[model samples]
Target: MRSIRLTRMDWRDPAFAAGLTLFLVIGTPLVPRGQGIEIQLDPLGYTLLIVSGLTLAFRRVAPTAVLAVTSLATIVYYYFAYPGFFQPSAALVSLYTVAALGARWTALVSGAALCAGLLLISFRPAGLPDRQAFDGPLWVGGWFAAVIVAAETARQRKAYLNEVEQRAVDALRTKEEAAKLRATEERLRIARELHDSLTHAISLVNAQINVAAHLFDRDPDRSRTALFAVKDASKQAMGELRSALEVLRHDDEPERPHSLRQLPDLVKASEQQGVAVKVTVSGDSPAVSQHVDLAAYRIVQESLTNAARHSRASTVSVDVRYDYDKVTVRIEDDGEADSSSVVREGVGIRGMRERVAALGGEFEVGPRPTRGFAVKAVLPLGRSEDDNGGTA
Candidate 1:
């Protein structure tokens, strides 16, 4: 189909000119050439033919002007009994030129004028014939039909091409929009991962550094412990970052999951900084979705980090309660009476809330009844059988 279209376009201009020339040459032999009832071919008739040919050459460049000049010459030739073929041939080229150049009204009016000229030129005033001679109306009507059909075909073809071009443009725009949407989603996922990993690690390091700074002179051994805690936090941060990068580089690799099973290491790391965290696992840990487990782990991490940063709390409690169909986590600090004063809504709290919300869960963060702030989260564990199977 594409090759055919290319061929048609390649030959369109020359084809139109060639067709018009053939029509004129074929009519030449049919011209009546005798003495009595014959059409006379005089100098005036030759002049009209030359002018019509010149006008045909300019048909595509200036269709209306060519049609007008040819029509006027035909009318003058009628005064000297010239042949009727010249006007109809010129009008056919004029109709095609107007259609190709996006001038539909010009094509229509020129077709009408050609039909009128053919009618006048073919009329014989002498007598009616036994057999009908091809007279005015037949010639006029035939040329009108041919010209109008060609012009309408050209117009429809142009409209179809325009529609195809518009569809291609729309498809390109939709593809670009989808690509932009995917890019935005990927960025958001990366941001959430960074918040969960880097922020927790940084908070732990900051707590250890503050402890080491305080104990540098009085207790060098305890200060050494604080330094070790900072080292562990930094290593864990690098490990998580590397894991994240690995997934980015190789999408097919299975992601390693973070869960509450790692909570002991988290507390010991904080205890090294002189912050005592009391951990309790009340009910059997239910089987949970990977999304729910990750959210639970992040909530505890952010809560403990917040307590270490903002409270003079000597005792922090990390509690996990697992039910048949749900898991609940609660972190509370029993520190200075003014611990709640330092707690404010920050990115960590916002991210924890967002994570819990993503899993059809609920999160609450505010001051506890006794003292200090508490962070609590509850997540569904799917069916009871799944939750029981998840027990470890």
Candidate 2:
């Protein structure tokens, strides 16, 4: 009786109880009278039958009381020498309800009590301690045991089904939460990738376009160089964008992985945009992780883009230093020192900072010491052994 099957609304309880009561009230009296039946059922016997059957209406609500009332009514009716031999159906149902409600031992004991009491009515002087004398009690015990077994079986089935359904709901909820987290992470990755690559390309193209337009009338040769720079910048931008998108198309790793080795190409591209860059490399470089290499490269690239776009300076300095535990990249320009010309931090600056921070690094961008703007980033290699073993 450790389980219950009450999982949904039951509107049929009242109707079912009423029908059962009517069936028992009408059918019990019609049962053939037993041998040596001395008295016919009177108003008292009819009252007891009605009381026993009516008690079944509240079996689930008050199973113990219902069982008691029905068992008592059946016993009393029999003790009075009623002619009919049929025990009340309500007694059997209430016994089953008690067990179904998780009182198996209690229902079994009650069944024994009912059998003992009913056995007295079946005993007679002529039936002297024989097989027939025990037959009535045995039948009662058999029916009670069967009812308990059936009720217990049904209750167990309901419990198993409810558990299965609960597990399914929990699994689905967990799956949905995992999916939402993955989507959020993917969005961040894509946004960071596009902003880092495309912003640099667009800034270079803008610079070359401005140069070409200004020199179109004054110097055809210089203007043609500027136009070629514009075309190259556009092509590199598309190529980088296509490469970045290819990873998404195949849902695979990046094909053209970034490294500090690309710093030369980055410097050349900036020079083509009319910025004279002098790069300085110091210290013995050590093997570093791919993320560290990539972060260093992007920091330098974005700094060049920023200097080209914001400052009036022609010559910018790019510096990279390799240390035992970290790599640092610094870019500075001789732009005008006027406070009004200083540009505020935007998406490009923020993206560079984000990249450094993600690697547990340091980032700095501001006006230079005397007459220019500067950007610097320091990226740490956190692990003992690193992947790619890429140069810094």
> For this target, which candidate reaches the highest TM-score against the unseen true structure?
2
Candidate 1 has what TM-score?
Answer: 0.65
| Deviation from native of the Cα of residue 149 in model 1, angstroms | 3.6
Candidate 1 versus truth, CA RMSD in Å, comes to: 7.0
For candidate 1, the per-residue lDDT at 39 reads 63
| Alpha carbon deviation, residue 105, candidate 1 (Å) | 7.5
Clashing pairs in 1: 287-390, 313-335
Model 1 lDDT tens row, 75-104: 666545555455456656666666566666
Question: Residue 279 in model 2: shift from native, Å?
Answer: 3.3
Off by over 4 Å in 1: 1-81, 84-87, 97-113, 124-140, 143-147, 154-158, 267-288, 310-392
Q: What C-alpha lDDT, on a 0 to 100 scale, does residue 163 get in candidate 2?
A: 99
lDDT of 2: 0.77
lDDT of 2 by residue, 1-392 (tens): 33432323245655667787677667776877655643676888878877777667777777888899988987887677675555556788988888877787878888889989878766755432566677767777788889989978976787799899999999999999999998786766566667777887887888778888998999989889988887888898898888777867876656456778887888888888778999999988777776778778878887787777768679999899988888888888987745445557777787788788878999888886677888889889654235344434
